[model samples]
Target: MEAFAVPGLPEFETGDDIATAIEAACDLRGDDVLCVASTIVSKVEGRTATLADYPAGPRAREIAARFEEQTGEERDPRFAQAVLEESTDLVMDEPFLLTETRFGHVGVNAGIDRSNTGGAELLLLPKRPSESARRIRERLSVDASVVVTDTSGRPFRHGQTGVAIGWAGMPASRDWRGETDRDGHELEVTVESVVDELAATANLVSGEGDDGTPAVVVRDWTFGDHEGSENLYRSVEGDFVRQALREWHYEQ
Candidate 1:
């Protein structure tokens, strides 16, 4: 599969037609999957907040104080407040607050992005990324899939990598549960996150900083019809990491 950036997109704003802009910049084809950066999706959806919008509250100040003590860097109380407001739960307090977002995504700062946005503004993840992708796909004439992506740091990993936050027109995972492996061993748990793989591959062209290419078209990929990114999340009851972290936090 080949992924190429969709060029010539102007700085997007609230209410801008993303599908039209993408079609104008690239030669869209049937069966192509479009990997769109979540930042642009947030921008177009008007999901932005200024520092003034998130004044430091009691919880924000408490978290900020702990964060600063651990990092040795002054934490912006307003930023901390915004992170808390965007999160459903604060899973950690030191290093950085690992938060579970309203949409059930766990990450630092609830994926509230400060980079690439104009100064003094922060971009939140789209309220419903799968819905956003589906809308974009419906607006375009070509039969294609859409995957909304964001850069995220993995546990124990040094660098950030692209991950799929929302998707439409394709299964987020490919399950090989009943299939046999090369050694004829039945694959009980061998699901592949095809959406995330596509997002990471698309990021090869859509760089992290100043790339200006927020969207990419991936060609020559096969996918089954599926909707949403819910499959990408591990259920809370089954998440061993979360359970262990909760226990560790109580011990501390």
Candidate 2:
């Protein structure tokens, strides 16, 4: 698959839109997948946070205090929590809280970004990436797939990598369950997260610094005309966390 890097997208104007920026960047002649950094979308839509306007230092300190108080852990968990807040989507739940973005991404943070953006404001995940993608598809007159990505901390990895929080016009996952592997044994259940893979691929070009690139286009992706970004999320019946935590607690 060929990836084209689009650099230095201008700030959005009132009437300015994602499709216009895309048209200016590349010739997306029908049937291509476009991957966008969530930061860019946030910047364009003016979704930013101002720590200076508030007592950020004191707030951070308070956060640190509250976290320690709750968990009764000595270390400052709230420092991590505050950083997480900068990147998380706050979700209200019973007893404990659950944080996840609209794209079915779950974590302590919602993928909010404080890095880059000229230090003016923190960048948030796209408001509604799938909707944004749909709009872009309609305007471009092409068979397009839109993916809005944000950097996320991995479970066992050192740093961060991009993940899909919102998508449109693309297959979110590729299932390979009940299929034969190299050993020719039937696979029980396994699904590849195509959207996350695409995000990682796009990140090769959209580096952290102001490299001037915010988007990438994949030209050789195999996609059907009617396919869109769905079928990516698994259903949750009851207290998935409780079951997992129970297993983990026993394993410990």
Off by over 4 Å in 2: 12-15, 52-62, 67-98, 182-184, 223-229, 233-252
Worst 10 residues of 2 by lDDT: 88-97
User: Please, what are the lDDT tens digits per residue for candidate 1 over residues 1-252?
Assistant: 788999889998999999989998999998999999999999989898898998899988987888777668898888989988888877776667788887777888899998987452899899878899999999998988999999999887799999998898887888766777789998776678998999999888899999799999999888654322348877679999888776664221
The best candidate by lDDT is 1
User: Which tens-of-lDDT digit does each residue in 158-211 have in candidate 2?
Assistant: 897877777876578766666686899987756677888888888887877767
TM per candidate: 0.93, 0.72
Clashing residue pairs in candidate 1 are none
In order, candidate lDDTs are 0.86, 0.64
| Strongest candidate by TM-score | 1
lDDT of 1: 0.86
Q: Count the backbone clashes (under 3 Å) in each candidate.
A: 0, 8
Deviation of model 2 at 84, angstroms? 9.8
